[model samples]
Target chain A: MSSYHLDHLQHLESEAIHVMREVAGEFERPALLFSGGKDSICLLRLAEKAFRPAEIPMPFLNIETGHEFPELIDFRDRRAKQLGAKLIIRTVDDAIARGFATPKPGIVSRNQLQTPVLLGAIEEFKFDCCIGGARRDEEKARAKERFFSFRDSFGQWDPKNQRPEIWNLYNARLNQGENMRVFPLSNWTEMDVWEYIKKEQLEVPTIYFSHERDCFRRGGQWLPVPPAHTGATTPDPYAGARPTEKEPVKRLVVRVRTIADMISTGMIESKVHSFDDIITEISAARVTERGSRADDKASEAAMEDRKKAGYF
Target chain B: MSATISHSRPPVSHPVDILRFNTCGSVDDGKSTLIGRLLYDSKSLMEDQIEALERSADITGGGQINLANLTDGLRAEREQGITIDVAYRYFATPRRKFIIADTPGHVQYTRNMVTGASAANLSIVLIDARLGVIEQSRRHTCIASLLRIPHLVVAVNKMDLVDWSEERFIEICDQFNEFLPRLDIKDVKFIPMSALNGDNLVDPSVHTPWYVGPTLLGHLETVHIGSDYNLNGFRFPVQWVNRPNNPTDRQLHDFRGFSGQIAGGIVRVGQKVMALPGGQTSTVKEIWTLDGPLPEAFCPQSVTLVLEHDIDISRGNMIIGLDQLPGTGMDLHAQVCWMHQRPLQRGKKYFLKHTSNTVQAMVTEIDHRINMATLVPEPAPAELVLNDIGEIRIRTAKPLVYDGYATNRLTGSFILIEQGTNATVAAGMLLPSEQLVRPESGDYVI
Candidate 1:
């Protein structure tokens, strides 16, 4: 008799695949929220396992903050094309130009601005459900989220009034105009994601590995320094506010631990190069994965506030 | 093992075992505090997390640091000094990884507790040492049993408040054991500890010299949950049909497979299987995992199964072994825990979602409500209010393949959704179909 058992990584993969299939079966207009991050990359692999022999039942949706890493954007588009899935991109720059969102004065980071663009895209595409790669272990607010999170007609999430999800039965019923944000990787931790990437041999943005780049220090984190002022018509908003003389720009060898907007995503000074190195580093690290994300460090309730405002 | 790594560091090479459990008790029984102690002592708390806890100490009042703040993430929950929702926390020791579902312990939040316990392999029922075995303790224990949780740990908290008396701990243990036999739970372990003072949580405390049992964390790390899954009858509720149909790749041109997570038992290639409701028989040709094809698959592992001959199978269809077949019927007798604000009344139609199948169902009769305090069945309750547990008879529009809750949780459990609001109103555990009320009986006339 063969003893069949799934290790932790395989178990998480199974659970995630099951959730993706559930989304495919229940929703008429479901889309995968592909951010080109490690978690989202894992989602793509799970999607392949879920609906193989057939195309992923839904399209790929991405909300682009114009300030995103060039590598991430390139990888996102190439992967989507390789899979032959429909890719829909919505930009924060367009949301600002259309008067749907207004940039806060002197605030160059478009992390908060992406929420409106995402909501607009959802409304325009009439996506009944959007599958995201958000994991509960990422933040405190995320820890309270349900597997099948229900959103009101306005896309607002009421954390206190979430539907009770019992066993494997997910309540995916939504009224017209209402939507659901499905998270298939809710139970996965950061280590699990990296281990899975290694097991599946999935490709990620090259920036995740060690590289040399010009960087600057701000708020105790290393951030890539923007190139010399390119005098364009738009006039980059971030250039308007330069780093103080106390925080000098210098060329350094560093790598990004997470891929987000280029302005807010922090680079860590490390010699770690491969996925194995990353797993070892993460196991010995003291800070949470989101500690490097300046967007979430704005306040204690930063994620909760964004979630309430319909941010994925 | 590497010599360069320090002995104090967590062992990373061990095969990681995942344990999911929930903590439930009365509001002030220190459920959250016990979880915080476990995480803190296990060295799972990061430097930033400890700093955050220290920073919020002033806001939460009391010169002392409030450990409960770790699990209570929501602003409202922190301000109200209570856990209002189920917040999941992950931590790991050298031995195992754990997912802690810190559920609200208030009486009105029974639905939240039920949600937390639904997927737990074990349940920790906290009891205040000063106030041994109260009504809330009994209520939570009954719920743990109803959910069919395989393991139970009765943590007698606040042992310091009771002067660390061995007699007091024994008294509480005796009280719990008196009622535990009535429930179906087989394994029960009791421990005396103080979540606030950190006694006997991760390390054995000198104050409890009279106690000779594993520490709370020790037991959690070594508890035998290997046999929790049902490995007797093969049942696979198809979640999707994998048909790639890619023309360029010759191998993918004609691939068709039934995809789902195995809910029970072990399935091997060449095994004879039957599709439920259709009664179509076929032999399993191959089992496919994400990595590659496998010769055999077992319960809880999601895999795609290829059959020798394709019969009519789709989502909501169950593939099972012919030997221990599940009951097929339209009438179901079940025990339901009402979760909605509106009372559950007879004659109301609902969307009964069992496995992947959803069917229109109606509450034909309300048998009786179980009084949590007395553990007695009250005859003929007119309606089941929010958080009430009662026996009910339901009739579905189509036949459902199922087993008794005692036999198989995945195949036996279901949720009732209100047709209009689509809100999940109740969670139900099916009784055996033989006990189902016959249509010819006088009860069906209503």
Candidate 2:
């Protein structure tokens, strides 16, 4: 009948839920790479719709850069506990402490430092698959990413040699030490994520909504002022770089377009307070969501390079 | 003034459906420029993305700002000036959302084209107006027909170079009409446009006053895609068995439901259905979705169905409506697109994953490989190499319930997984079954 049609949001939801179920049916060990962002929040809801009533048959993994917004970290913990899912937090600080990473001078953001920590966790837990929330519309390199992106034993993505994914059938076959980075939201856009969140009434981190925060301008982008305490033992995420007098601190009403390390995530000035406002804002957005991500601005192929080095 | 007010609101103010399509053309055919023109003219390009394109030094062709750099994202692709992999681009109008699978067009990348065109509802085959119907155009059209894309648009690109000639466009259409009947495609439209100069892309061009038709964007926004799904025979390949068994919740404590995406037809509560391989019949007690319970479910909707009786249906079982039953047999004949470098031959075993079921299958015979150049069957090919399209027969260890690929793409399609590498070796389409009746032991529970 004519009423059998599913709206765009419903279609995207069904497609994502099918992908999540495929991982559950196929893999021996799979983990959802939770970042407490809107995309992963949508992923959690899709997972619930996929394998609910029965517990989600996978753990939640978070690679903390030690510079994460406290609100996001809190939300991540609460959501995982509410679902009764296991939350595994592997920090870049821990990787540095274990001598697996040496921090480069003047590089404040631990975004790139997250790769080794993530790879180490995969090796430690022997997770055959890690489901991520990466979308094709986010970045250039990510646009070409397959649903079941294969990584070598070294956790490297060889873009040119990606397996051809056809139909709804995916080739999830892998050898030992190798694993898959599954993106159920590969076809979803930023607007789609917000729309699904609105349709499903899924709660995201408070940082996603506009709020007053201490910030300063750098590289023509807003950066949050790390708290004074800023974790006593670990090195200050804002060590080498601090806002000078030329770049004065301003209390701007800002909200994050993408959730990453507080040090590298840029804040856009907006008055979006609800999902409706967020959807409206993203619809008219002239720049991409990743445009606010300071880490990707380092090099044109930064995401691709880090992805090849096993970054989620 | 009302139009201006409506424009301020987002295009998705109301419920809109999605359309997935791919653009196919060879090198120097302006495939990327065509995509760039569409995105640019449709106002889908972001401000920062355009700035990046302007800043990049890969500009070519008289400094008109190479729009292809927007899609050719990889470093090697930028250096080599070609698309190496499938890049998905999304854009939306007031009417519908679009998912463009920008596939590469080299002969060596036939597998990529097949992969991109698999889930596409329509395909745009770009033809160089100067060159007319080339080898890549025929190859792509043949692949689109093989993949069973519902619609095809032969975009006669670079009309500016040809002085906007209507005869040139008609000649290209005639060339395609010669081989189109051999293909399975039903709907085809010919558009004359210059993607480089933004002619007849989103808006109609003044130069083509003699030629009257809907612009490319107008056609994409209003294409009839509502009947694209198969809605005749009910087919549900169970993907997972949902049993919440929550002690706290009484409703979910004893719930035993079969969860899957409906592959075909419409299923309703209180309808009599049959399970395949064992041929047991049961009544549909309820249909559950994430939102709530529904009276009926149609093709492509994922839902959990509860049966009236306690049946032994698990993750690889098929639940079907009694009216139009699917084929049940262990021997299969199908067309396959071999993907791996290792050539396919007889006696090689594989893990055949059809629907949600996977069974051990062996190749019985290689019927013929379709020659793309001539669109003819080269009989009894010794082996099907990588990116080769061929017909083959297979014998599976267990019986599968399925339909013909022409009838239903979801239920009738399968992939062969190589054992050791776990590499997907082939994408298959099952042929129509001769026996459509019930199986030998028809134990009706009614």
User: By TM-score, how accurate is candidate 2?
Assistant: 0.96
> Can you write out model 2's per-residue Cα lDDT over B274-356, one digit (the tens) per residue?
87766778999999876788999998988889999888988788999988878767789999999888988689889998888
Q: Give the count of colliding residue pairs in each prediction.
A: 4, 1
Q: Is the docking of candidate 2 incorrect, acceptable, medium or high quality?
A: medium
Tens digits of per-residue lDDT, candidate 1, B327-355, equal: 76789999999999999978889999999
lDDT: which candidate is best?
Answer: 2
Q: Where does candidate 1 clash, by residue pair? A: A53-B243, A53-B244, A54-B243, A54-B244
| Strongest candidate by DockQ | 1
What are the lDDT scores of the predictions, listed in order?
0.86, 0.87
- Native contacts kept, each candidate: 0.69, 0.69
Give the residue spans of candidate 1 off by over 4 A: B1-11, B248-251, B435-446
C-alpha lDDT (0 to 100) for residue A310 of candidate 1:
92
Give lDDT tens digits, candidate 2, residues A59-111: 99999988888899999999999999999999988899899977887777788
**Model 1, residue B142: what's the lDDT?**
94
